[model samples]
Target: MDQPTRPSKTIACLSALIKIGSSQAYALFDSGSNTDSMTPEYANAIRGPRIKLTEQVTLQLGCIGS
Candidate 1:
């Protein structure tokens, strides 16, 4: 049987909610959003092959702004 391949580096994410004075604060530690939230500078820091969405999708629009 062929063994699975392992990446050179591993990524992990942790989320927790802590009670504050009058509200709860969410704490997130991870690579960050998958939807490309990193700045151009930070994106260049990654040292691996990056996959980007290339499919062109059509979005249906209803009459609203007219």
Candidate 2:
């Protein structure tokens, strides 16, 4: 059987960049070694850690502060 591919950290990093409107490249460090998943600006906006407890998919929506 083929092994499932884990979600790419690059994907998340790019997402954060797009969301933040930044042109620079970003990297997503592992959650195990990283304290947070968002950019510096986004880190402050998070109320708390967001955990996905199931296989259910969902969308995260938020506005970037200008």
Candidate 3:
């Protein structure tokens, strides 16, 4: 079996999330990633308006967990 790859470097930083238009606060974290992304459920719950998709494109996702 292949061994999982490890991150080259690890750094700790303070995280902060701000609302789109208001001064309210919100935060979503994923230990696996330091990128700024949110789950669909969380987005939908906090989204303001919806933009209809004009195209149908297939998406392929990688393994969700190691």
For model 1, residues 1-66, the per-residue Cα lDDT tens digits are 876887757545576885544545565644633432323543455433456759953544346665
Q: State the C-alpha lDDT per candidate.
A: 0.51, 0.47, 0.59
RMSD values for the candidates in order, in angstroms, are 17.5, 14.6, 6.2
For model 1, the local distance difference test gives 0.51
Residue pairs in candidate 1 whose N, alpha carbon or C atoms collide under 3 angstroms:
none
TM-score of each: 0.25, 0.18, 0.37
Question: Tens digit of lDDT per residue, candidate 2, span 1-66?
Answer: 876788777345322333334334355444444233455465445443556657864545445752
For candidate 3, what is the TM-score? 0.37
lDDT, candidate 1, at 32: 38
Model 3 residue 37 lDDT? 49
Q: Pick the candidate with the highest lDDT.
A: 3
Q: Decide which is better by TM-score, 1 or 3.
A: 3
* Candidate 2 clashing pairs, residues 3+ apart or interchain: none
Instruction: Say which prediction, candidate 2 or candidate 3, comes out ahead on TM-score.
Output: 3
lDDT (Cα, tens digit) per residue for candidate 3, span 1-66: 987876757544556677765434566455665445445765576664555779864554468583
- Least accurate stretch of 10 residues (summed lDDT) in model 1? 32-41
